[model samples]
Target chain A: MTLELKDVSLRFGADTHIYPTSLTLDPGSFNILLGTTLAGKTTLMKLMAGLEKPTRGEVWFSGRNVTGVSVRSRNVSMVYQQFINYPNLTVYENIASPLRVARIAEAEIRKKVESLAELLKLSPMLERRPGELSGGQQQRTALARALAKDSDLVLLDEPLANLDFKLREELRDELPRLFADRDCIVVYATTEPTEALLFGGNTACLHEGRIAQFGPTGEIYRAPKDLVSAQVFSDPPINTVTVTKRGGEFRLADMAAWAAIGEFANIADGDYTLGVRPHHVSPLARGENPVGIDGKVLVAELSGSESIIHFTMHGATWVSQSHGIHPFEVGSQAKLYADMSRAMLFDKNGTRVAA
Target chain B: MNNKTINHAAWIFVLPVVALVAFNAIIPLMTVVNYSVQETFGDNTFFWAGVIWFEEVLHSSRFHDALLRQLAFTFTILAIEVPLGVAIALAMPRKGAWVSVCLVTMALPLLIPWNVVGAMWNIFALPDIGLLGRGLNALGFDYNFTRQPGDAWFTLILMDVWHWTSLVVLLAYAGLVSIPDAYYQAAKIDGAGSFAIFRFIQLPKLKRVLTIAVLLRFMDSFMIYTEPFVLTGGGPGNSTTLLSIDLVKIALGQFDLGPAAAMSLIYFLIILLLSWVFYTLMMRSEAQ
Candidate 1:
């Protein structure tokens, strides 16, 4: 089924939770709501699920307007982040509850419950209650129950957020494949940029109760419509600096200048904000037309395969993430390279002007 | 190497509580034990007796009658009050200004003194002039609590239910409110009907609170005293004479100390045993 949200907006008294936005999600591709905490992801999901009604719009599903319909009337399933399950029921019964509510035959219920339990690797603990299972196992039970419903719309609100790191990795790898063959509209919400990129479907970047951008996941990441979209799609946070364009060159406040090249040369920039991803700004020069930037090292974090250096440049803190461990001491001078060819320039109002 | 120091100094901190318990519970209980085992008359005199008092209290049909009556009253009130309280709690508004109003109204009956409740019900149910008594009489029903043992029992049970059902309502409401909203939302998305929601979600979540409510009401109703004493006075015969009232009649009215002491111990033991059984059963069910 195709789920469509048309001009939907939600407001609580004087505060707005979701602005007027339209989105249409198809069955074959996974849809993602990407945002930071309290960025209206959950509220938007609730509107789509009919858990909450929009103050101003209608929800359409498969050519029918389902606005104001109760969630129980709609074939929808949701798995919460808190690993919510019926605490008093065994895992098998918990998975069977929806089928029972649907009044499926006992034999069919047992078959579906057994197959779901086996798929979730919970067959060994089918008789155990939710209280007796580990966090991951309990969440798996919840997921199993949701899957057993076989609804046309399934909403997952950060299902792996509460699991431990290794458990999250395991479930994350299995999630996409689990929903692959099902002809359903899957809406997954997350605050992690890496997770959104890893899913690689249709992404709707939500920022401060507004859809900053929505398109194919890779396309949105590679070419954000605005600075807010870029900011919402970055993990280490995209670095930005405002500069003036005059006489075929961009001039910074510190008197450093660079000849505008490629897309930069074609834009008429009075005062524009330049955004560079952390990886694009490295301690060593690599990309074409690299520009040297000097700053005072503030913090240096080294993982096994990455070096993230935080430095102060032009009175603003900037981060440089690259491979190999580069130990830069605090309060020491450091020079980083920014690839001008890869930088994104935005207008004064935070609209992307040039790549 | 096991190296743990015994802290005798901790006893000093607990000394006050120990002394308080000793003076209030231990001393009074020892006095009862003394009375249970000995025959006492005037002038602070005592005669050493064995288990004669226990045997007498155990064998007396008067004691058996009162015990039966007490069990009947306790179970009847439980059967009526628990479900009624849960229904009232469920009907209450889950949020907004009405919640506090409902809570305060539910608490009003519990705040009244036991004897005052009894006296209020007595005046309210008087066959000659009280509102409820006259209203029932005018409605073509023959109801006089003072003259009929069945009417007395009915009034007594009605009064007790009114006085105590609020306790269960408050506890059940507390349990109902403490459940996270996500469960209900999930249940809605799962296509659960209202009854199924209650049976699987609300009822199981209420188990702990209901257990506490049942245990408290059971203990309270089983040992009820002043209300029945003031309302019925164990009167219209011995029909309304519960265990505690009968024990009081024996000890204070007829001055039979030995038998009263033995009966008191037995009553205390019954309450303890029943409460333990209830707690263990409820906790075991939770464990599964």
Candidate 2:
């Protein structure tokens, strides 16, 4: 079903849990709610699932106002972050519970449960209780239970967040295909930007109980509407430096200047914060148009394939994620380069100045 | 992980509890064992009774009748209290100021002394002037607990239920509250009705607490003496003379110490065996 929230807001006493926000989620599309922890993603999902009523505004499902409807009356299923399965039930029984509640035929329940269990690779463990399964297996059982209902809307609230790294990667890869042909509005919430990108769906980036931006995932990542959205979409955080514009030249802390290029001409900048992603900021190189800045290496952390370099530039800390091992000694001065074409600028109010 | 040093000093802390158990449980149990094997006449006179008293008590029709009555009472109350307590717990409000009020009221019955509960019910169920008895008689029913065997049984069972069902309610409430909200939410999302939720979610979650409630009620009700003894005084026709009352009549009233001791040992063993069977069955089901 197509779900729409019109000016929905939630408040716990005087504290606002979710600000007034409106969103329209089309059916048969994979929708991603991308945000950091405590960003109101779960609250918004609860509102859509009818688990929590909005303090104001209305929820429309399939063109009908359903704000007053109970969760049991709504055809929606949710898989929580923590693997929530009926502990006393076998995996097969867990998957079949919803069908049994619906009073579906026994033969249909058996067929559906077996097929879903096979699909989730839980065929062998179907007779085992949730307490006996591994975390991934338990989550799969929960997923199977949610899927067996064949509801119009399926919500996954950071469903892979509790699993180990390897299992998360495996399941994250399988999610898109799992719901590929399903005629349901699948909403997946996650804190990881890469997962949203990997899922390849329309995303709503939320920050501080508000939807910062909502559009195609790729488009939002490429062109964030505001500074918060840009920051929320970045992994190791976007590197920002305050710069002032005079005529066609942009001056950074009276230390460096570069001529305005392309869409920068449209921005009437007095003082603007320039944001460049960690991947875009690299070790200094002498080829082409590169905006260079001097920084002192603070710390260098090397993972398996890449190293994150923490450096101080213009009295502010910045991070640069370099492609391979590029170890920089602490307290040593280094120069970083940013390609101007990939840089983003925001005004004092944190609205993105497109370039 | 196994390389940690063992602390011998921890035994010092455990010594007090061991001594306490020995004093409170083991010593009294040994005394019962001593009495069961030996016969005592009066003024420190004693003789070897061997297994004769056990055989006599086992063959006695009076003991058999009291045992049957005790079993009937225990099972009857178990049947009534467990479901009634769970239903009451389900109806109780899960939150807000009323929670404390409900809990306190439920606990009030449990806190009253067993004899006081008996006394209170005895007056309350008096045929001529008592509120319940007068109300029932006014409602046109022949209700005289003091004179009728059926009414005596009814009053006894009612008194025990009123005295002990609160324990079950408290335990079931605890089990119900411990269930996470996620289970209910998931049930709702799956379109489960209230009965389905209770059958699949609440009942399964309450299994452990219900087991404890059943076992406790079984043991307590099997050994029940004070409440019914005070309420009906074994009744006008011995209708409410449960095993404990009969055992007390043999042991202290008529001073038949040998058969009474043997019967007490048998009673202890019966409770032990039944509790073990109950625990084993419940655990086996849980494991499966």
Q: Specify the highest-TM-score model's number.
A: 1
Tens-digit per-residue lDDT, A108-137, candidate 1: 999999988888899999999998999999
Please tell me which predicted candidate would have the highest lDDT against the true structure: 1
Instruction: For model 1 chain B, give the 10-residue run with minimal summed lDDT.
Output: B191-200
Residues B242-274, candidate 2: write the lDDT tens digits.
999988988989988778889999999999998
Model 1 regions more than 4 Å off: A255-257, A283-286, A289-317, A328-340
lDDT per residue (tens digit) for residues B1-288 in model 1: 879998999999999999999999999999999999999898889999889999999999999999999999999999999999999999999988999999999999999999999999999999778999999999988999988999999999999999999999999999999988889999999888789789989999999999999999999999999999999998779999999999999999999898889888988998999999989998998877
Candidate 2 Cα misplacement greater than 4 A, ranges = A11-16, A53-55, A62-74, A86-89, A100-110, A237-266, A274-301, A308-320, A323-343, B1-17
Worst 10 residues of 2 chain A by lDDT: A281-290
RMSD of each: 2.5, 3.8
* TM, chain A, every candidate: 0.98, 0.97
DockQ of 2: 0.51
Instruction: DockQ for every model, please.
Output: 0.70, 0.51
